[model samples]
Target: TAAAPPRIFPQAQHFVSKEFCQTEFGIVYPPVISVSSGELIEVETRDCFDGKIHPPPNENDNNEYNPAQALQQMKRAEFNPITGPIHVNGAAPGDILAVTLLDIRPKGVGVT
Candidate 1:
């Protein structure tokens, strides 16, 4: 069966890279993008290895893939490169916000 076309959110504030990724949560790291409450947003994320893990170089060379290599080369003391600083409007410290998933599409080239 054929796949559906990617969903587009014309009103969504899109974030499609790891440029704003942070290892730890701190005040010094400001929000990369901010939007009002109930606003749609899109965030593309990297793998937990910070993109160190990868598919084999060739179709026949599956053994070439190694997770330990990626882990050793990671920069953060923690796992998963968290990308966000989305400041939601009207969301105060004491208030709780909820998120709804409209759709999730896997893009090209996932780590094997």
Candidate 2:
């Protein structure tokens, strides 16, 4: 008997490259784009989170400190916000984002 083959997902077609990883902010890099020569792509990125830290008032003023404030402060930060829905000058509906693969660099030993 023959062994079964691996499954290929339908949504995978959206990517030009089958081999790539998501950036820290979550943009998926396709293998084709990764290996392409002289190709530049603009990835919209934003601050990982809003800069906010709450420190209790100093006791030197005889003020009371509330540890419960940390939870309330957490909601103020935003996570992985995208900066744009930027429009390409010549891009129109039904136009495919064209890319060509020119290289594929392998990870070092013991690395993926």
How accurate locally, in lDDT, is each candidate?
0.68, 0.37
**lDDT by residue for model 2 over 1-112, one digit each (tens)?**
5543232333232223221223233224222233232334433222333222234567776766554554355553343444333334555579876655333343232200
**TM-score, per-candidate, Cα-based:** 0.69, 0.26
Off by over 4 Å in 1: 1-8, 11-16, 59-65, 75-78, 107-112
* Candidate of highest lDDT: 1
Q: Candidate 2: TM-score?
A: 0.26
lDDT for each residue of candidate 1 in 3-67, tens digit (9 for 90 to 100): 53343665666644555787777778888887787677777666666666666477676566656
Q: What is the lDDT, from 0 to 100, of the residue 8 in candidate 2?
A: 38
lDDT of 1: 0.68
**What are the candidates' C-alpha RMSDs?**
5.8, 16.6
Q: Once superposed on the true structure, which residue ranges of model 2 sit more than 4 Å away at CA?
A: 1-44, 53-72, 98-112
